[model samples]
Target: MAKKTVEAALKVEKLKVEITKLKETKKNIDQKNKQLKKLKKKETKTKKSKVEKIEKKKTKKKKVTQLTERKTKEAKEKEKQKAKEAKEKEKQKAKEAREKEKQKAKEAREKEKQKAKEAREKAKEAKEKAERTLEEELQEQLSPEEIEGFQIEKVNMEKLTNKVCVILAEKETTGMIQSELWKKLKLSSRDGSRLALKLERMGTITREKILEKGRWTYKLIIKKTPISTESIENAPCLTCPVEQKCTLEGEVSPRTCEWIEDWVTIEIKKPKTAQ
Candidate 1:
């Protein structure tokens, strides 16, 4: 009975020791569980931060790509606008050029019309002037008898002819109009017109058709002056005793007259005097 009680006490002690060891093991397991839980929490926080950073990067890249596309679109639009403006400017320039050409052509046509009008007027004036002269018209209205009977009264023909020559000489080669000559000579138009015609017919004056005081008229120019009386002062016919009987085909002919021959010879030998 004593051995059995000792054995039982030993057994109780072993059991107590086993209980203490179990309590220590339980504490160690609790501590390990706490550490594992803290590490898991830290790992979860790191993963969340990485995910947020990746999201931010993706958003930034998207914004950058959108900005690049927008800028490229804007550039393309600007280029299109520039090209449109250039085309419009070119069209405007062409329109202006066409307008300028049209204006030039119009002005040229107007100038040509004005030139043609002026030419027509000039031709009309020339045709009227060429129709007839005043002196010719005056003579055509007179009869042959009236023209033959026309003479200046109280005027010596030789003196009158010499005075007309002197006046014409003063006017040089340009000559004087018939109206101005008649006024200076104090002669009537009727007599003056007849005298001018007679002088022109006699080969002592020439008549040129001209426009004077807006009328067709004559310009008289001296062709030859009248023979001076002094030129015949020593002529034998004036003093010859047979002057009445002397004729070109008579018995007392000038062709066989010795005195006339001698007088002609002497006049030919004399030096000519200037008028």
Candidate 2:
């Protein structure tokens, strides 16, 4: 209980960190906007100051205009050039500020989005963890009788394999589909699939995947034993009476058999069926 509480608290703390990061992103965006606004205000002040300077020049020129008309003309041209230069400079500064604000805003948005994604991932993990914990708790609380529908039993692999081989031999070269075969064998689909793969890997049988109803199904093809008529007829094991007890190292073995030696010599000379 204490451990679980600690884990929950840790998750909450992580979530708090994500929230703080998001807040910081927002604050940074707000600051950028404020700086942009200040730049606009500065441009407004520069325009206002230029206007005041132009008015002062106009007043000073009015008094000298009747006395020197040519001089007044040159002064007006110079004032116009200065005003144009000032406007251009103000425009450049505003453009640079706007570009900087856009870049900062993009960065802030990306940071917020990243934080949101991380929060979502954390939330998903937490939800899965809680679900697993609840499942474990439920399992601990319940008895065998309380949840008594399903039963799991161990599979006798050797028995199952022999049975499967027998079934396949009956079918011969004509293979049976996985679903039908498993149903007939009374095995679960999952277990049957595993068995089929096992047989395939061991070279006992071949399994071919087929698409039926847009879902993958298996066709199990049995690998028949390679035995020709002559080989079976010449095989000493066929005529051996103590075949059950016979081994290569035993007294009733093929090593000291004169019958088998003669049969092999004859087979080498001329091939014939025993029966």
Estimate, for each residue in 1-275, the C-alpha lDDT of model 2 and write its tens digit: 88999998988898899889888988988888888788888878888888888887887777667547766776787888889888998998899999999999999999999999999999998865644432234346655444332222555455556667768878888888878888977877765665665566567788766666655566788895323353447777787777887779998677877777887887668632111
Q: In candidate 2, which residue ranges exceed 4 Å CA deviation?
A: 1-156, 169-174, 223-275
lDDT for position 24 in model 2: 91
Which 10 consecutive residues of model 1 have the lowest summed lDDT?
144-153
**Shift in Å, residue 113, candidate 2:** 17
Question: CA lDDT, every prediction?
Answer: 0.80, 0.71
Candidate 2, number of clashes: 0
TM match of model 1 to true structure: 0.39
Candidate that scores best on TM-score? 1
Candidate 2 least-lDDT 10 residues: 143-152
Clashing pairs in 2: none
Which sections of candidate 1 miss by over 4 Å?
1-29, 104-275
